[model samples]
Target: MAIDWKGVFPAVTTKFGEDDQLDFPLFEKNLQFQLDAGVNGIILGGTLGESSVLSLEEKGTLVKFAVEKVAGKVPVILNIAEGATRDAIELARLAEEWGAKGLMMLPPMRYKSDHRETVEYFRATAKSTSLPIMIYNNPVDYKIEVTLEMFAELADLENIQAVKESTRDLTNVTRMRNLFGDRFKILCGVDTIAMEQLLMGADGWVAGLVCAFPAETVAIYKLTKTGRLAEALEIYRWFMPLLELDIHPKLVQYIKLAEERAGVGSEAVRAPRLTLIGEERERLISLIDGAIAKRPVLPEYHSIVV
Candidate 1:
């Protein structure tokens, strides 16, 4: 289950029951649904996965569950979003012990670390485990940008191999390619700009809305990779409205609601992040319903592989 670091990797949301417990059946069903749609990897405990609210033991359970359910068919990556360096290192080590094939790591969770601290944090964590790491570089949200110089400093760390490119500057993709060659595999993190990033030489997408619209997301990626630009754009235009939902502050609730409406997921979110209500709910429902009512016919994309 080596991570080639290509294709659609969904930042899947953690499913929950009315009782607020982890709903294993629902989780597995959605996970299997994503896999069946031809996604390349599964990312557990990411922002969408509610990593902040999950207990240490809960995170371990998810890794074990995803690993077992995925059955080594694809790489299951556990996201480590710890605030402390020591804790991040411990979690990285535990991920390997729990059978995680790879890791997607964010910078120090609550604190906005400076360049040196950020590099050190990633350096220390990546050095801790044998698991291949995809550095989550979303400065817009996480507030810590892994600058090119910082990446160069970490270049010698073989385990810190790939990046979830969320800087929102698409040209940074070319910058990385020009600077390091392929030393770092780049996966587009923003759903809205995915096709653009892919068209510009991104290796893959660490997608958000794909949690709900798995098949469409994969279709876009496969279509682009296969050079079916016209077909890809057709779907991408239709998917744009849905993809915009991923950038909101309440992205978890927004995407979960999309999932619920799509009949592949539920709307139950953890506390401090309640489900959408009022105009927000109405607006999203209308959007999701309209998209479903007008769901585009996907051309056969399975033949095209990345």
Candidate 2:
């Protein structure tokens, strides 16, 4: 599949049943919701998707399901977060075969590899398949930063294409643009700074809050790119509180709770990640409800002048 590497691509939540099983029917509905709102692509098995606990078989199932469900309307990407290099390589191969348009890869999980090993992990995985790769550079959470120097080294690999820029230093967007030119596409990984990064030269956004508020997320991206900064900022300001939920330790649960309030999803999470309860749950519900109450009446983003 060809990937444009631009626009709003949601790192969507994995829909699970109260029994802790994949909920295909609800998942299909939410996918349609995002597509209807004009998301450019779908990313499965991501951090927001709860990839850590998913079996390789389950990951493969998601890739294949999303590919078939989307039916070429938009690209479907699979997040690769294996703990071993060999496993990452295997997943990369399988992802391509399963019809993932691209791979959003993390620097091999669990252990903190140095710059050299991190480069090797991504390099070796890229070499395993023909699929395009978006290296996830979220050192704040991942512990290893794929520096500009590291990116210079990776430039030779044609398939190691874009990056999900989550270093949290908004200047990194300009730094990446200055250093790499158009060689590597930069997608803002943190929702809180998405508008600032896009203004700074990010090509797209790998958004988390988009899972619940798809239209608002896409509207922000469309409005900004089309030189409607003021319009975008108004909506983005409205979205800030909910967007911050993506940066938390319990992001999966928090976002799902938002999804639940929006009439788009469930709050059932897998074992070891029980559903939110009591005060914490009520606090988030208050926030989500409050935001939904004042949801912006958006402009016709699809018809915006470029």
Candidate 3:
């Protein structure tokens, strides 16, 4: 598939049944919402998807389900994050076999590899599969930063096509564009800084909160791309509070609550990840409720100007 690697590509949460099984029905509903909202692509088994908790079999099921559900309307990209190099390679190959159009892979998981080791991990995974790869550069949570020099080193790999820039440093976006000049596609990975990064020439968005608020997320991207900053800012400011939820430690619970409030998916999560309860739950619900009550009526999307 020819991926433009630009626009909204939501990092959706993996819906789970009360029994902690993969909830295919709700998952499909969420994907449909994203597709209907006109997002550019769908990324499955991401951090927001709670990929670390999912088993290999469950991941395979998700890949196949997303591919079949999307039916080529948009690309279905699978995220690969493993502590070992070989495991990552195996997952990448599995994604390809299951018809994923692209791979969004992180550096070695759990173990924080140095620059050299990290680059090798990504490069080895890239070599082991034919799938185009988006290197996830999230220094904040992952603790391993893929610096400009590291990216420059990995630049020779043809399948290593794009990046999910979540370094949280806005200047990194500028530096990437300045250095690569679109040689490598850049997607904003942090929700809080999404609008700032997009305006600074981020090619796309690998959004987290979009799983709950799809339209508002898409609207921010579309309005910004169409040179309608005033309009985009209107939604961004209203959406900012929810966007901040994406970066929280309990992001899964927070986002699922938002998803429930937004009428997309259930708040059920796997064990070790409890459903939000009591005052904690109440506060989040209040945030979502307040936003819902005052939600802005977004203008229609225009043909992307940039």
Candidate 4:
């Protein structure tokens, strides 16, 4: 199936309870909310979803739940980014069987410097399933960059259909667009750089902040595509302050907190991950409130909980 890899695809948050257990019910509610808000797809287990912290079982359950809840309304792309090729392949196969539309694999973090090792890791994982694979190339998180040459090599693999170019490099996005032509789809992975990337010829955006403000993100994307830059910039300015949170170390926590403020989900997160609290929490709330105040009217789907 040719997935329409466009519009707002939110890197969803994994809701947790006070006991640090996955809140499946809350997760489903959150998923439903994003879909209702008109997201094109749901990216489960991505960085924003805190994929690294989830156990294999938790990953499987969440993928299954997201697929079931979406029910053909939107594509569910599972992040099968394991440190080893074997585990990634296994998870890829599992996700395919669980009804995921595609797989998003990141570079193996174990071998930081070897580009060949990273290439082999992705090749082996792609070989395990026929599902289309989207490379998650975020050098900031992985510490290893997938160069244009490496991306060119991966593009030859039939199932390697798309890339989530997280590095905020417009030149590289243009290079990929030049090299691959239409063979590979490039989706902007950085929320703050999305409009520029799109203008530079990126096919779609895999946004994290869209979890809180799907309507605006989707609007910006659509408007830019239609050459409505002046109107889009108006929304972009309001989004810029909130987009700053995407660069923070505790982004997942911040996004979940924003979701809570928007009444979409809880702010609770698993251990090793801390929720925003005290003055820091107050600052975030104020920022969000300020963003809300600047807008003439909030998206109809959003309701302020605090």
Better of 2 and 3 by lDDT: 2
How high a TM-score does candidate 1 get? 0.99
Candidate 1 residue-wise lDDT, 49-156, digit = tens:
999999989999989999999998899999999989999999988999999999999989889999899999999998888899999999999888889999999999
Index of the highest-lDDT prediction? 1
> Which regions of candidate 1 fall more than 4 Å away from where they truly are?
none
Clashes of 1: 0
**What TM-score would each prediction reach against the true structure?**
0.99, 0.98, 0.98, 0.94
For candidate 4, the TM-score is 0.94
lDDT of 4 by residue, 1-306 (tens): 557766678899998888888998888888887787777788999888888788988988888888888889988989876877788888888898888998888888566858788888888888778988888889987788888888767776899988899877879888887787888888999988999998898888899888888788877787777677877788888899898889889898888888888877889988788778799999999998787667644333223110
Sort the predicted structures by TM-score, highest score first.
Answer: 1, 2, 3, 4
- Off by more than 4 A, model 2: none
lDDT of 2 by residue, 20-115 (tens): 889988899899999999999999999899998888888888888888889999999999988899999888888889988899999978899998
**Candidate with the larger lDDT of 2 and 4:** 2
lDDT of each: 0.93, 0.91, 0.90, 0.83
